[model samples]
Target: MTLPFFVYGTLRPGETNHDRFLRGRTSSEEPGRLTGSVLYDGPGYPYAVDEPGGVVHGELVTARPGDYRELLAVLDRLEEYAPGDARNLYERVERGVVRARDGLVMQAWVYVAAPPAAARLRAGGRRIEGGDWRIRS
Candidate 1:
C-alpha cells in the first residue's frame, strides 16, 4: 500500500533522520496521532508500542508520487524491517492516524515495536508521557 506514514521519532521534523531521508521525498507533513499505542524511548530513537488506552503523537507524512517506492525501500532498510522477518525490531503496520487539524482518521503506515521489543517495552520501558517525543523531558 502506498499510504502515508506516521512518524513519531527520529523520522519526524527536525530530527536527524528526517532530513537525511524525508526532506525532499515528501509532499506534506501534518500533525497526527496514532491511537492504541504508546511511545517508548529507544537507544537514540523512540518506539511505539501497542497498548490499550494510549495514543502517540506524530506527523503524517505523504511521499512525493515519484519517490514512493524508493522511499519505501529506504525506510524499510532504515527501520531494519523485512516482511515476515522474525528478527525485525519494528514491524510496519497500517493503522488509523487521526489528523490533528480536522480530527480525520487516515490510514497510514506505522512502524511499531516488534514482538520482542514490544513485550519488553510493555513490561517496563521508559515511557514518553503525553506521547510527544519532541517535548519529552
Candidate 2:
C-alpha cells in the first residue's frame, strides 16, 4: 500500500527542492497539521520539534507505492535529515490529522528534530499554522 507522508520541511511543495523531487510524483496534496511541534530556522534549513501548543505546517502527500524508496531517498537528501542519528537532525514520527472538515482520522509520516538539536537552535521561532508554507512569507 502507498504510504501517506506528512512533510513539514524542504520536501514541502513550492519550497526550494519541490520541482526536483515532488513536482509530478505527488498523487494528492492537502493541508495538514501536526500537533506538539514547532518550526525552527537553522543554519541551512528549518527543523521541527516536540513542543506543546506548537504546530508544524505541512502537506499530506500520497505517493505511488512503487515510488516509496525514491521518495525516502529524496527526503533524506533534501532535509539533510536522517531517521536515527545521535544528533537527531530528523526523526520520523507519527502524525495525526483530521482530513478537511470530515474529521476523519488521518495518520502519516512526520519528522522532528531531536530535542537537544531543537534546544541549540535558539528560540522565538514562529509556529506554522494551518499547514500553509506561505504563512511565513
Candidate 3:
C-alpha cells in the first residue's frame, strides 16, 4: 500500500535530512504520535524501537503523487532497508499513528529499528525521554 510515512527523526521538518530527502516532495506534513514505540539514540539519528505502551512524536508525511515511488525508493536506500536483509538497520512497517490535529488514527509507514538494533536498544541503549527525538540532549 502507498501509505503516508511516519517520520520521527532527521526527516521531520527543519531536521537535517528533511531538505535533502523530503523537501518539495510532500503535499502534507502533519504532527502525529506513534504509540507502541520508543525512541532510542543511534549514531547521529534516533531509532524508533517498537515497544508496547510507548509513544513517539513525529509527523505524518503524505508524498505528492509524482514523487511517491521515487521517494519511497530513496528513503528505503537511505534507511538501509531491504526486505528480509539481516544487515538492515531499520525495517519499514505499517503502523497506526494518531494525527495531532484531530486525534484520529491513521495507518502509515514507519521505519522502526531492525531486529538486531532493536535488541541492542532494548538491552542497553539510551532512550530519549518523553519519546521526542528533537528534545534529546
**Candidate 1's residue-wise lDDT over 1-137, tens digit each?**
78999999999999999999999999999999999999999999999998889999999999999999999999999999999999999999999999999999999999999999999988888999999999898
Residue-wise lDDT of candidate 2 within 3-73, one digit each (tens)? 58887666777777667888777778887777777777655456777778777667788876577788877
Q: Candidate 1, after superposition: displacement of residue 54 in Å?
A: 0.6
Give all candidates' CA lDDT scores: 0.95, 0.69, 0.95
Q: Write down the worst ten-residue block by lDDT for model 1.
A: 117-126
Q: Would you estimate the TM-scores of all the predictions?
A: 0.98, 0.78, 0.98
Q: Can you list the residue pairs that collide in candidate 1?
A: none
Residue range 13-43, candidate 3, lDDT tens digits = 9999999999999999999999999999999
What RMSD does each model have against the real structure? 0.7, 2.8, 0.7
